[model samples]
Target: MSGRRSPGDGGLYWDEKRGRWIASLTVGYTAGGRRIVKKASGKSKTEAKNKLKEIIRDYEDGLALTSSNETVAEAVRYWLEHGLKGRGDSTVILYTGFANNHVIPAIGARKLKDLSVEDIDRWLAGKARQLSTRSLKIIYSILNRSMRNAIVRDKVKRNIVALCEIPDGCEGRVSKALNLNQAETVLSSAEQADARIGGYIILSLMTGARTEELRKLSWSHVVAFDAEREVWLPVTETGWNHTDYAVYVWRSVRQGGDTKTAKSRRTLKLPQHAVEALRRLWEHEGLDKTDDCAGLGERLVFTTKNGTALSAGNVRRDFRKVIAKAGLTAAEWTPKELRTASCPCCRTPVSPSSRSHAWSATAIRRSPRPSTASRSTP
Candidate 1:
């Protein structure tokens, strides 16, 4: 019986002692022994043959006998908590929000092995229905990153979400800025006011500086340049609000901090009008008696009555008030809109040069026969 090979049964035979047709396979060495494995049930011969064939094929393919069986939610959590542990706090918040609000609810229970490209597309479409395309894109990026981590661990074979596209209507909607007349009216209204809010409004409109950059402007980065000399800082140590005029470098806010992009970091010369507004703000704050006047290099350009940093929310609220007080429509006015919409003759975006009131140069140069320098707005 031991020497005889069974016909058409592969390695399967009837074990008389066990009273069953035992489907035996020769597995590789285990503990210095050639382990022969057998599986049997009181089933038909065909069923036995099929089951044995599957097990043998799987073994030959170098597949594990058991799976990690990591669920999507569980795997994503592990990936986030361990793999992305070193990411910034803001990034972590964004990823966590996307997972909690979008990914987990859709297909979180499925094992990582079971995720498919179709599953990702369906999930992305459903997310697009709820969130803006930009928000949906963020969620997709996080989930895709998580799945890629799973691939690295051999938990999944591919990243399905990478094949998906951001759905329609999920794009960045560009809000138009105010025209030149409206910008003039808004700036004029802010100028007549007795508070730093007016100056903040003017700065935003003139330089296209983001709200926080203006509010958090310090004296250290204030470069004083005249047409006579290239840019340089004055020796006098005065608070930014007290300085007559100064150049604002977008980078001076915080090196390697949150900003839109590298191109967003700009240097714009503040006009005399804006400089006067800053001086008045300085006198109003009574900084003459404070250490900040000596150019301590740390004072909020726009602050509350008590000299605390001005919140963007509060600035927007006050900006609307100033607009209304000036008999302007709040609907048509936003600080960002005011900055970018002022110059159509040049047909260029709001730039540091445009902010410096160099409209004529920018306008005349755009005669269709462009200079190489004219094409580069940076």
Candidate 2:
């Protein structure tokens, strides 16, 4: 009597008042124990069934009609609160800042289901004025990943953000390094005044060690060669000057105090200039030799006069002074750039004992490609 139809086939019947065929399906039940029904209307019964099929396709693709009221801000907030499980605190702070400052403020009012390619495009275009291209890309990644998380949880049917292309953003600061001539001036200038910074520049330029790696160097890692025994002994054991020397580069100031990469941990034979500079520092500090390595090795090779660890600010301020002393523009250069300086095989060549380490074996001969690539801008 009633137009109930088969269970999956959906009910089709003529609506006399509207003069149209109406199709309705009792697909399932809602979480609150209410029936979930879908309905469509068309002039013909066939058209009504086809319209019903379209709704089924959308449901199959994970699109939920009830989620239409969920806003983009809600989705972004959900991700910020509960999504980042293993991510670092700094990452959480950074992503939260980006979302709140840049992303959410612009498009957060829109419904998640209604977000479109044009919305994202216009948002990214506006950001181009304020952020660098790299920063824009990062925010774009954050948005795209958030949308992907929403899709997996059935908050949305698909990630339209994935379809959006990143637009070019504002320019960024340029990175550069000293050339060979400038390297000579900095070396000569530092050696005349401060052994700490002198050894820093020589070792950084000669070995290409990162600034963080150098700062974390301890006395125990510095080893002096034993001519008779043919071995490398800690500066803690043998004191500062032996014929040849090397440093065990196993430490850094990275998260958990590990090197940036597995291969970054290495042994580097000191260049003659670096050795002399470190020797001067050892004597200047008047550090005493000790038989117990546990105590002696823990002593940092470089630190503030207060014996605390050096901060980036401390290094940068001192390094700029060194730059000014070298007759170079202090405002234009940085300590990290020393590693990227061209022709590392400056006048104070690596000691003939370079063969002791694998990287140092060819270190004296193979200079990294000219560092002029980054300076192409300014």
Best by lDDT: 2
Pairs clashing in candidate 2? none
Model 1, 282-325: lDDT tens digits are: 66767656754445455666777777766646777878888888
State the C-alpha lDDT per candidate.
0.61, 0.75
Residue 169 in model 1: shift from native, Å? 3.7
Q: Report the Cα lDDT for residue 127, model 1.
A: 73
- Once superposed on the true structure, which residue ranges of model 2 sit more than 4 Å away at CA? 1-57, 64-74, 77-83, 88-101, 170-175, 192-198, 254-263, 280-286, 289-293, 298-300, 303-314, 343-378
Q: Give the per-residue lDDT digits (tens) of candidate 2, residues 35-114.
A: 88878889998899897877677666656533346778888888888788887666798899999998899999988889
> Candidate 1 versus the native: TM-score?
0.65
TM-score of each: 0.65, 0.69
Clashes of each: 3, 0
Q: For residue 110, what is the lDDT in candidate 2?
A: 89
